[model samples]
Target: MWQIFSRFLALGLISFGGPAAHIGYFRKAFVDDLQWLDSKQYASFVALSQFMPGPGSSQVGFAIGYHKGGVLGGLAAFLGFTLPSFLLLFLFAVTSAQWLEISAVQGIIHGLKLLAVVVVADATLSMFTQFCQRKTAKMLMATTAVAIILMPSMLMQIAVLVMAAIIGGILLTRGENITPENPPITLNYSWLALFILCLASSLYFIGQDDTIGQIFAQFFQVGSLVFGGGHVVLPLLEASVGDYITPDRFLTGYALAQAIPGPMFTLATFLGADLWLESPILGAIVATIAIFLPGFLLMLVGLKSWHTISQRPHIAGVLAGVNAAVVGLLFAALYQPVFTSAVIMPLDMALVIIGFSLLKVFKPGIVWLVMGFAATGALLTLI
Candidate 1:
């Protein structure tokens, strides 16, 4: 369990390209490499996480850990995956104001933004191939894509998910059975106790306006309410921190969050650093803890019920629909943040096209692409 946690933690430190990409990384490591769970189980968990909310990739990580070693396993996975981003955000929240002023940092970020587009595009294609195998699933994918592109509103996205659930339920009236060839793993009481302890501590510490207290309260709320992944957290975080931090600073931190590795929730790092610089270290700590609290709680609740939930045909259908919609959401994200924000010139457009080609055609590792682009961007900035 500790070994698994250590591996996931290392992956979290270096993993970039958002939730979709994180899924790819997990598939490669856990499914393809580790053989921890079969493809079907993985698909089910991914679908379940997508349906329930609170950062899909993070939930996936927890599920992987849980499957491997029960509740303690889940905690290890969450900690391993989250720690890097937490540490990075802490440093950034402390130093971003100074570091971001550098032209090189700005240039590197600009280039990395284009890479984000390529990474997400690749992930969308991969997910569609994996999950949208059935004709009904394919239709859901197309419909959701059109709706998201046409509407592009938050409420509309939720409505699309709800409607998809209804449609999926109608289609999946006949049940599909998932037989576990191996015996089911038993839950560990110790892990459950620890999880409960964390929850209790968070609740106890979350008091009115104190730095740590506010962190606990705010993150707990976000974790509890956020349905989508990191992107969904953006507007919410902006609203929460905007009162204390400038819009420009917020935007800059957001941009930096995009460039770094790990979960997009690492945006908490920016919030923490901004608060820390603007106020105190206590503020930074509070902000960091607050942002991740919801996700942890959601994971705990979901794991308790996943066995029963995974069995229902209607639930499966909705997950199928949601997974398809996730593809569309990834597409929309590629268009907005990655393409719109970074690709300003003809050369920039060419670079993006090339990056997409490399990913789609060659399928080189993401790290290589990132490194190549970072160097290209640095050179471009000099020119």
Candidate 2:
């Protein structure tokens, strides 16, 4: 349990760039280094995460922990991985925003964003080699990437994955007879019931005068409804909160969440704190839990079954197609938000090349890489 927590905790502190980058970091740490699971198993988890509605990358981490040590391990992974970002956003909520404006801080954020580009690019390439070996699969990946890059939306993402699955089910399964191996299969329906109950409860309590209840209800609904990634929750949250949080404050939290490590859902932590002035910390805690609860509950419902069903021949082909599309999703994300935002100058590109080379060749510790990039970013500001 401690091992699970410690591993994910180490990741939470440095897993920046958003969901795509978090997936990359998880691949390197769990799949590449610790051998917690093989590449296919990790990819299976990633593929499953897309179909579910919560924080995508965090769900993958939780699934990995659950695979390793069951329910307690999953909780440990969530707490460990989310703790750093939770604390940071909570502090950001109560503190002055002036610190965010510091030149050194700006430089560090720039550096980390650049690091994200390098990390994501590497993951995209690695997954491409593993999942897109066949010509059809490669074309699926390329088309998915191009389509997403051309017209990126949650709807488009879902459609692409679904289409890929149908195509793979028909095309990729010929002469492929390997049986899928899954961990002990245990279907738990109680979790689905609990998720439904929570959603119902949120609707009921949302009309009440209790501020904390309202906070919980709003975020819980947002968690339940938003699909694809954490960024999707932003607008839902903004609309749900009504006038309780000003647009400026909400955008500030969004920006900070983007600039910080960990899940962007921690934006809920910030908003919860801002919502309830009486006991801001309590608000933060409740909001964070509320926003994250639905996805985990739904995951618990499906985790075992998804693994079991995925091992079948036809379903395996479906997953094959979905996995290929997922690589493309990562590829598209790397260019738009990850690459475009970070690589603003030739110097940034040069640094990315250096960092990518080091990652591939020397393979330094992630902690050291984070520190070095952060330091370089700050120094660049001074220069």
Candidate 3:
């Protein structure tokens, strides 16, 4: 448990670039270095996260921990990975926003964004090599990437995954055994039941006169319904808390969430602090937990059953399609928010190339990569 916590805690401190980048970081750390799971299993976690609502990368991390050490491990991973962002956002809520104007701070953000580009680009190529081996799979991957790049919306993302699954079911299955050879893990339905119960309770309390209840209800509803991870949650969060939060403050919190390392969903921590006037810290805690709860519960429900269900021939085919589409999804993400956001100047592009080469050829530790890029970014400001 301590091992799980410590490793994820390390990631929490430096896993920037948002959900897509987090996926890349997790792949390199767990799949490539630690060997906690293979590429296929990691891809499966990523695919499963796509189908569910929550922070996509965090869900993948949770699944990895759960894979390694069960429910306790999953909880540890969640806390470890989310702690930095949670605390940072909470602090942002309490402090003045003027520090954002500092040149050094801006430079660090720029460099980390570039590092995200390098890491995500590496992950995309590696996953593409692993998943899109055949012509059909490759075609699926290409078209999915093109479609997402052209029309990038939550609805579009979901539609593409569904289409990929249907196509995979039709064409991907070959001379492969789909039978469950190993003993299957037990499927725990209690988590699903708890999820439903919480959903009901939140809805019920939302109508009451209690501030805390209202906070939980609103955030919980958002968590339960939101798809496409943290980025997609932004608009919904704006709607959920618009009554109490002003547009400018909301955007400010969002900007900070983007610049910082960790899950973007920690925007909840910032907004939650404002919701309760008497004790902002308590509000932050409640809001953070509420917003993240439903996703974790649903994840627990799915993880218990995924191993057995994925063994079925049809399900396996669907998974194959989803896996292929995930590569394209990451590819699309790499270009837009990850690459476009970071690579503004020609020097940035040059730095990205160098970073990618380092990742591919030298394979240095991510901590070193982060430090190097951050320092370089800060230095670039002086030039």
Candidate 4:
């Protein structure tokens, strides 16, 4: 527990660049350095997290901790990674807005954002090779990527994934067997059933007039429904609470969150603090937990049955499609927000190529990469 907490805490503190960047940082630390999980194991967790709704990067972190320390470890990882952003977002809520406008802070953030660009690119390359090995799988990966770039919406993502599954079922059904890594989760069906029940109950009553209940339901619904990942939270949040939250506040929280670490879903912390004036702290706490609850529960439930379901040939084929689509989805993300957003200038492009080349040659730990890029970015501010 201590190990999980401490490691993730360091990650949370230095972490920036959002979900795609988080995955790169996490893979370097947990899989490459710690040997807590192998690439295949980590990929399984990533696949599942992306497959389901909720915060993509956070859920992946939770699964790693779950793999290491069971339930307690999962919670430990969540707290450790989220604490940095949670506290920072909360502070952003209470403090004057001008604090974030400082030049040094902006320089650091820009550097970290560039670091995210490198990290995400690295992760994308790794996942592409691992997940899209077959010809059909490769084709599906390309198709999915193009489709997403063309239409990057939550509903479109869901449709693409569903179509991928169907294609995999038809084209790639007979393939090699994937050996099981760890045994099934011991949490069992009773807990999973209860989780589903609560999720369903929350959705059923989301229209309630009560303030807290409404808040919980709104977040829970978003957690349950979102398909793409943390970045997709913007539109859903707007639609869910457009009338309640002012455009300025919503945009403010989103903008400030970009400069911080951990999952973008921590936007809930800011939204909660901003929306519920009487109890800002309570709102932050409740909204954070509520938004993340459904996804966590789904991981517990889904991972338990993954072994049994995956063994069948037909199911495995569908998973192949799903995995391919996951890659495509990530590939699309790497371009839009990850690549296009961060790589603006000629220097930015040069930095990314240099970072990638360094990673390929030395294979240094992510800490070195993060620090190096951050320093480089900060220094570039002078020029």
**Clash count, one per candidate:** 7, 0, 0, 0
CA lDDT of each prediction against the hidden true structure: 0.70, 0.80, 0.80, 0.77
lDDT accuracy of residue 244 in candidate 1 = 68
Deviation (Å) of 280 in candidate 1: 6.4
**Which pairs of residues collide in candidate 3?**
none
Q: How much lDDT does candidate 1 score?
A: 0.70
The residue-by-residue lDDT of candidate 4 on 88-117, one tens digit each, is 999888773566576665565566666656
Error of 1 at 236 (Å): 7.3
Clashes of 1: 7
TM-score of each: 0.72, 0.67, 0.67, 0.68
Worst 10 residues of 1 by lDDT: 179-188
Cα-based RMSD of the predictions, in order? 5.5, 6.2, 6.2, 5.9
* lDDT for each residue of candidate 3 in 159-273, tens digit (9 for 90 to 100): 7777988998889876576674755657668998999899999979887754798899988987875555755566457656866787556755765576678888888999999
Best by TM-score: 1
Which stretches of model 4 miss by more than 4 angstroms?
1-77, 80-85, 92-96, 175-222, 225-280, 302-305
lDDT of 3: 0.80
